[model samples]
Target: MLLQKFKIKSMSLLTFNLLLAIWLAAVLNVPFYERMQSLTPHTGIKSSLFIAASVGVLVAAYTFLFQILNWKWTAKPIAIALVFIGGFASYAVSSLGVLITPDQIQNLMQTDISEAKDTWSWHLVVWTLGMTVLPIIAILMVKFKPEPILRQIVKKGIASVVSIAIVCSLLFVFYVDFAAIFRGNRDLKGMISPQNMIASFISYYKKKAPKENLPLVTYGTDAHRVINTSKPTQPKLMVLVVGETARAESFSLNGYTKNTNPELSKQNVISFAQVSSCGTATAVSVPCMFSGMPRKDYDERLASHREGLLDIAQRAGYKVTWIDNNSGCKGTCDRVHKFEIPAPLKQKWCDAEGECKDEVLVDSLKSYLASIPAEDKTPQLIVLHQMGSHGPAYYKRSTEQFQPFKPMCSTNAIQGCSRDELLNSYDNSIVYTDHVLNQVIQTIKDVPNYQTGFWYLSDHGESTGESGMYLHGAPYAIAPIQQTHVPMIMWFSPAWQQHNATEVSCLQQQKQALRSQDNLFPTLLSMLEIKTQVIDDKNDMLKQCATNPDGKA
Candidate 1:
């Protein structure tokens, strides 16, 4: 009887392993596999294999623990829970194409999960079915066997913990070496164990410094200052509109079918048709665009070392202001004047059933802009960061009035949404954005005495159901055009033209120049006429024009 029981347990273990192998194979079908291959080619094959093996081992260990503890009836439920957890975790990691940092993961869970509560009911249903109902059915089939004694279970639990630790150690080692190979960094010599190697790899990243650290030039400096020594001038006002989740592919300015940018198209706006983004996500792009570092070298360690464009504008004697509608992450605009919409007031914007709209943030913006102190300005730089077209809940992005297309709202979740539906909802958001942008441009146009120029660029673009992908955050190397091909437009008022002819001509030249966010730092300094000793002549767009004389082809 003992021999027969041992054979039964062995067969059960084999079945568990087989099921886990099938699940592991299916996990690779998630859309991010191709992107992962492109981003870290050196570790791509090994990492994929490691991930598969880890999942298999984790499932097997869970099965073994349940059996060894004689908690056979409970095994099915625990196994089901593990499956859902593993699948969701894999999906999230695959979508990002990298292992998410602890802070980022925490922030994402807090904000995105809360925001997605209403629309993600289907996900909850799936979890319930897998974790509860399926397990009960499996338990009934096994005749609901009684659990083993607590002492025996404790012994099995300790063994399972040890096994998990070993598996995790192996995974950590592989991941660290993979990252080192992908980044082309030399491997550590002294690190013998996986845990130590991971520690060393993290230390290396934390200690890495920015490739360049050029100081900013402001308006009062002697080398390149723009302050009027000859005569007094009126306080200038410039509004830099930092758009959100806006893709260039959908904008009319970038040859899209829809007239999404009708107002800006009608104005004297210069749209750079081929503008690319530094990163696909706001966390990286927002800081990178503002900082001096190019996307290739952008790292969190350099965030504090470098001053942003806002800092440059502020040092140039401009009052910097930031009005934000997005979730406050990393406090990117801490030094600037910040006005966040009240949470209680925002709650009212939700429907009787509790659904909210993006326009609610816009409504708050209108009131906030009107309340700004009219008197104070030594030339003010107001940054309006819109909640724009942030999604998954694309249907809630805008109202029906803005919806030009029918059957627009995404019927499925972001992952399953049809391309046509995604575009329709996305375009509607752009339409609403255009209206808000028009209001901002008109307000800037009406501002007296100040030479106003409005520049608009999205943090990054979005994937609207492209190649079975529905959102942004693809790895940089293989990030689709939808994520990087972003819309950029500059509108210069007649007053700006009258006061700064040299700057206007420089901007016009830059319009044709092969520009990136790297040029943004020096370009803003040149436009504002801020002089500083720290500006690199080689990187400065204006200096490039001065040297080339012939424009960039």
Candidate 2:
């Protein structure tokens, strides 16, 4: 009875398409317009004119596309999908202050179930449902007046032509302003509703599909460990901790006001104050860091198909292992011994949601070290991938004791929380990470008959409501300092330092030198004394500071 009483009147399909397009452009694009209002220099009449032109262009563009699919069978489904996609995309852009670029789309596709749960909250549900409800209802109720197929094609063609003309005219009229805005702010194109999401997905899939058929390319095939008679005969062991979303600005060692690195500060670690990441997210950074490719020349397809640092280390007779407590190693540890936390161990450390703390990696490391054969004394290269400071569920990342910063932003709807609340939550997570790193350092220190060392480098930094940005994954060109500047810390046991003749004082003096993820591959090779033509000595961060055991540089 309610449906019958409130049924929308029938209208011609052409009229319906035009109205629907207008509704989508005007209503679903509130975030786009809001962003424009902030960015536009003009005010009053000029600003109003620009926005009107933008809306006209958008409506015509939508009309042109909708007309192509305005057939009886496909019209409703396409319209409903547009509404749904627009609703969610708008919410993400407005609430999280994220631009859904191709890299971000890849991050979404690659993310695991446990990582995905961190993004869930009632706020997303309510906002998306609210945006989609009325549009979906109107779509289901409204009737379309259908005509013959031949007539429909001609009408749709004419509409498409008119749309093209209108778009051209608007561009011609506001060419100067449009060009300036587009060139100056490349992110504006990515901020538009649904269009950005559509374009990014299409680009991501197109690039990903062809790479599946490419053959693997190996590097450093002739890699070998160089023996030094002056150095100690004991085998070497290095723990490489790949941290997630840990920003340099949050660490007390990096000059932050908060004591976020209490444990690390007490340890005999050298914290590099200036280290930039290769990319703004883990999906890109992890592979690039190990692939030995600088960010300026990084190609994901190339990196994916190539042999990396781990493969070379293993070839040099090291026991390469990847112990992951976060997401998988992003394919960097494919050929190595990859140990994911099993279900049995979850009973000891994990919550009901199957989220385990970084301590699990420490425990796993202890077990693995104990299992090493007593007679076989090969050097070890173990990578511990920690889920460090990944947000906006920052409150969940740290235990109660580590969370010295109070009144944290507990909800995933982080935008709703005050900036202080968000900072407290993020900082607390860093504190926990500091503790975890120190624990790993301690574990390595006790390993007998081996020269042990530990190295920690975060994949990327994050934004906590700074300049209206919440999380990481902004486009690399326009990414903020908070999203690119990551923390890098290292510690070597006294035996390891003496055995390799490492100049700790020289390393401390060079702490403020600028470095990046590009240094990772060469530095790791140098530390393991893995001799290969692929290892660029200039890129080796430690090579310049270290002297030979005979006091020769």
Give the candidate number with the greatest lDDT. 2
lDDT string for model 2 (346-372, tens) is 788899977899889889898888889
Per-residue CA lDDT of model 1 for 152-239, tens digit only, reads 4565566567657755666576666446544652211111111122343454455532234535323223333467868766666767
TM-scores for every candidate against the unseen true structure: 0.70, 0.94
RMSD of 2: 2.9
User: Where's the lowest-lDDT run of ten residues in candidate 1?
Assistant: 187-196
lDDT of 2 at 443: 94
Please report the candidate that would top TM-score against the real structure.
Answer: 2
Model 2, which residues run further than 4 Å from truth? 1-6, 148-158, 340-344, 545-553
Quantify how close model 1 is to the true structure by its C-alpha RMSD in Å.
Answer: 8.7
Candidate 1, overall lDDT? 0.60
lDDT of each: 0.60, 0.87
Off by over 4 Å in 1: 1-82, 90-114, 118-124, 131-225, 304-306, 340-375, 410-412, 415-417, 537-539, 549-553
Taking the candidates one at a time, how many backbone clashes does each contain?
Answer: 2, 0
